[model samples]
Target chain A: MPRRVALEGSHAVSEAVRMADVDVIAAYPITPQTHIVERLAEMVANGELDAEFICVESEHSAMSAVVGAAACGARVFTCTAGQGLELMHEVLFVPSAMRLPVVAVIANRALSAPLNVWGDHSDVMAIRDCGWIQMFAENAQQAFDLTLCAYKVAERPDVLLPAMVHIDGFHVSHVVEPVLLPEEETVREFLPPSEYPFPLDPDRPVSMGCYGPPYIYTEVKKAQEVAIENSYEKVLETFKEFKDVFGREYRPVETYRVEDADMLLLMMGSYAETAMLAIDALRERGDNVGLVRLRLWRPFPAEELRNVLRGVKAVCVFERAISFGMGGPLCAEVRAALYHLPEGERPKVVSFVGGLGGRDVSVEEFEAMLRRAKERVSSDELEGFEFVGLRE
Target chain B: MRGELSWKELEVGAIVTEPGNAAEYRTGDWRSERPVRKQELCIMCGNCYIYCPEGCIVLKEGRYETDLYYCKGCGICANECPKGAIEMVEEGK
Candidate 1:
């Protein structure tokens, strides 16, 4: 029995985490990410979730607490955003390296120097090499569904990696959308209790996260890389099974009207929903356009992305974060993925970064970017990334 | 050293699966100098015993002595001795 209910993206994520029967949640609140942990805290207080809700001091302790909890073989979770994420940066590597299945959500926010709290990908892009399995959710439903899938994939014995579900701050986290909640028994069958092989216990007397001096350090790191790379199989399998049980489909790269399009708009996070509207508006106006949304961000589906973009003419990557000296981070990775394709088959990846600090890139604006991408890939020489709406 | 272990053979999570595995590392080979104790000046006050970074000093015969088997020859024992009973001699001699 599934019930359709309207839920904000933050509550949607927290609801799925509750259904997963987590053992611990160590979270410190930050803007946008606050709603999610607040909901979880409420659930724990109401006895709706039978889990330890630890109110930690800072985002660093929030992450470190989950690492310790996961090391003790507990199903753990945490949430953070923006500057809070950077605070937790150093401890972020512990879960993945220690092979702990700590599932957390990032309500994606812009990093600060001038200090702005808004929806963006800057927080996520900074931690691209942290070795966590990251997935970007386009809307509330996807956020809920992916959070559930994260637990299954991360706890897989062969995978044994931490997971991050990225939902755009304010845009998705605050917006209310309809999500289908499956029965508790259904979730129980889908995600079994985590069987973490190396639980820290006094009786076992095993040392974890031990110092890896010289020779073994390289060996250990190589093993970790291989493990995360190889997790694609389990992640895909779990997604398939989730469709069978929950009846909602999930994929590494979700496409909208991509067939025989003259150009494609590639993006991630909640913006894809708005981009879809623009694509439709353009499609109706006789411009052949499509949208490619990155659902899986880590152990990056490079080959899958290349396969999708191979026959396409060109792809305009719309991103919310900048790679500073370079262009959009996702655009850089997309180019690298398409680089191996035999010259003519590769699509010209046009990078466009905007909607930063939560500024809205309206439907009309997206249509313009597609036209710009087509013009550049069609007649004009290729240019680097463009920040679409910056004032002179 | 388990450095010979292949990537596949390394323990999951790189956890040291064995208890008391630190004792197996013969760090004494890293020594550039060794601590020597003079019997006459030694009061067995346990200054070196507490100050030795490796905790390798032991009271063998009512006098604190440095055990060379596990000591890294850090010279902390000689540096900390109030009576100047210990000297750091070069390893070759």
Candidate 2:
């Protein structure tokens, strides 16, 4: 039986990890991310969860330890935010190259020298090419749901890439919300125990992650690219299986009231739900605008994104992080996905950045963004990103 | 150098099933310098045999000789030799 419980997004992730029966939890504590691994630590110390909670000195060692554990065919997990994610950057590439499904949750935050510990997409965007499956959660419920999906999707034999569930720091990570925590038996039925097809064993020894010289590096990378791209289908299959068992359906690109809307606001992370708040109020006033949220960030979900935005006249890509000189990290990618649409048929993609460093972008701001975005589309100003709620 | 494998032939994560690599690959071509044992100044100390990571140094014809087939010319043997019994000469010479 599923029980409704109030939990912070961090504890939701830990609960899912606990039920997943992860073999190792190796992570150093960092703000926002701390609540997750701390709860996990308590679980292990109290023997509520039987897993090795390695006390590592730094995020680098934390990532390194999980890689080794995963390589040895253990279901491994770790969590980090902001600077901690950057600290683990180099080691982040290892699990994917070695095809180890080390599950992780990122309480996404801003990078320093301003030293903000608050939530944003900057932390996650920095690791875009790290070759890991990325998923964003809108709230505590999705944080719990996506973490479970991540483990199942990542541990699939053909798709053994590490996965990161991005839950907005402070917004989702610290805020307590009602979550439908599923029974252990249901999760067990959903995700089977993961086994690396070629487990490192003494009897039948195998050397993994060997050196790839220049001659083979390109080919090896090509093979890796093909493998990850192919995993998109497997991800969908996992989502279907999860839905069959849990009765909650998830898609790479999730849509809401898009059928008749001429304009749509596509966003990611927790703010998408806030955008929905604005969408509801606007819909009541006869505004033909909808919402499109990207649940899956990597393997890009290019096709699904296209399907959702097919006939919409314009799309306001609301992102929490900017890509500096160009525009929003997600805005650029959304444009590229829609680039192949026949010239006049493509939606005018107006980019906007807001809610940086845990700053709030209010319902009125989203409503204002829509008016400005529609104006920009009409004025043929579908170029560069406009910062919303900027102080004059 | 030409690769020994096609991309289609790569195992998952390129895991090497046959673990002992010293014998599987002839890493001789990797050497830019070769160690030539000075048979006359030999101490029979066996330091080269102990230090060679490839384990290609052994007593052959009553001399501690470096096997050319497997030596990577890492100069470990020359560096470890106390009596200057092994001289590392340029490969072309």
Candidate 3:
């Protein structure tokens, strides 16, 4: 039976992991993410969940342990944040390269020198090109929902790549919210039993993680690329199955109030929640403004993004992390996605960087940026990069 | 979990699973050469002893002897040794 409970986002994620019947969990405790591992430990201690929870020493060891477990044909999970994620950067490449179906929950936190535990995209962005399927959640509900969705998308035999579900640290991780927990039987029916194609069987032993010669290296990488590229269909199929089972549909890119709007704002993560508020406020004043929240980050949903923003006159990309001197990383990617479109159809996208280190972007400030962006669009003087909510 | 294994007279060769023991090798068990220190080149820097993946490299009378029984031969010791004190020749090569 489905359990109806007021659960925190972290607890909700833990609930889904428990329901998924993950065979092994290798984890370490980091701020914001510690709640998830704490809850999983409690479930194991109380016998509420039947699984092996390994208390690894460090984040690096945590990923390494999960990689071993997954390669050994066990459904595995782990969570980490901030500098802890930086420590595991090396092993992150191993799981995807070896094509082990491991899933990770990343509590999005600011990377630190002076040491801040707030939310940002720096940690996940640092590992963006590691060949893992990455997804961002807008709120606690999506945090819980996408946590389940990650397993299905990652474990597909055609797409045996590691996946990470990123949720803003304190905003979604520490916040309590109403989440609809699905029944165990329904989740089981939707997600098939994991069939480990390569398992450690004494009777049928095969080598894994072998040193390949140059002759086979390119072939190995080509297979992984094809697997991830082909995974788009499976992601859509599994999401449809999730919608059927849980009645909650999710898309790679979701548009809000964009039907008749000429101006659109492109953003991601928990900021999407605030952007929706901004959208609603603007619509009340008879302004044509909309928002597009990118859920999938890895596959670079180009066609879907273009289709949604093609008709819009102007687009503003609010990025949380800066790519050093180059400006907003997400804004650069969004502009590139629409670069090939016809001149008239291509929306004038203004890149804005804000919300780093858990800075709250007020709804009023968001509205002002929209007005400024529209002015830039009208005057044909839109700066390629603008830092929002800056003092100067 | 119960299986068939003869315990009465366990041969050394019985447990040392060689390549082609099965159709394919479990690369998980593949290890590097067990470093046998040439006493003449010994500089008791203890690099090999500290960096050995299996921690089987030990100092005996100012010389290092790597335990072949447990060593996977990752060659961490040979690679980490600052001096040319340890050489990792392939086992059974």
Off by over 4 Å in 1: B28-52, B55-93
Off by over 4 Å in 3: B1-93
Q: Least accurate stretch of 10 residues (summed lDDT) in model 3 chain A? A: A210-219
Q: Write the per-residue lDDT of candidate 3 for residues A1-392, one digit (tens) a residue.
A: 56667888899889989988898998999998999999999998899888899998999999999999987889999999988899999999888877788899999999987588999898888888888888898777888889889998888876777889999999899999888887788888777767767665676656566654444455566666666777777778878988988888999899899988989999889888888889999999999999999988987788989999896899988878878878888888888999999989998888788888888888888898898888888988766577778887
- How far is A56's C-alpha from truth in model 2 (Å)? 0.6
Residue B1 in candidate 2 has what lDDT? 26
- Pairs that clash in candidate 1: none
lDDT string, candidate 3, B18-71, tens digits: 334332323324554556566777678787787766667766775788766567
Candidate 2 chain A worst ten-residue window by lDDT: A211-220
Q: State the lDDT of candidate 1 residue by residue for A1-392, as single tens digits.
A: 89999999999999999999999999998999899999999999999999999999999999999999999999998999999999999999988898889998999999987798998999999999999999999889999999999999999999999999999999999999988889999999998899999898989989988877775789999999999999998889989999999888989988999988979899998889889999999999898899999999998999889888997888899999998888788998999899889978988878899999999999889988888888778775566788887898
Per-candidate alpha-carbon RMSD to the true structure: 3.3, 3.8, 10.4
Predictions in order: chain A TM-score: 0.98, 0.99, 0.97
Q: Is candidate 1 or candidate 2 better by TM-score?
A: 1
lDDT of 1 by residue, B3-28 (tens): 57889998777888899887766678
Q: Per-prediction fnat values?
A: 0.78, 0.69, 0.00
Binned by DockQ into CAPRI classes (incorrect, acceptable, medium, high), candidate 2 is medium
Q: What is the TM-score of each candidate's chain B when compared with the real chain B?
A: 0.75, 0.73, 0.60
Compared with the true structure, the alpha-carbon lDDT of candidate 2 equals 0.90
Model 2 interface DockQ: 0.54
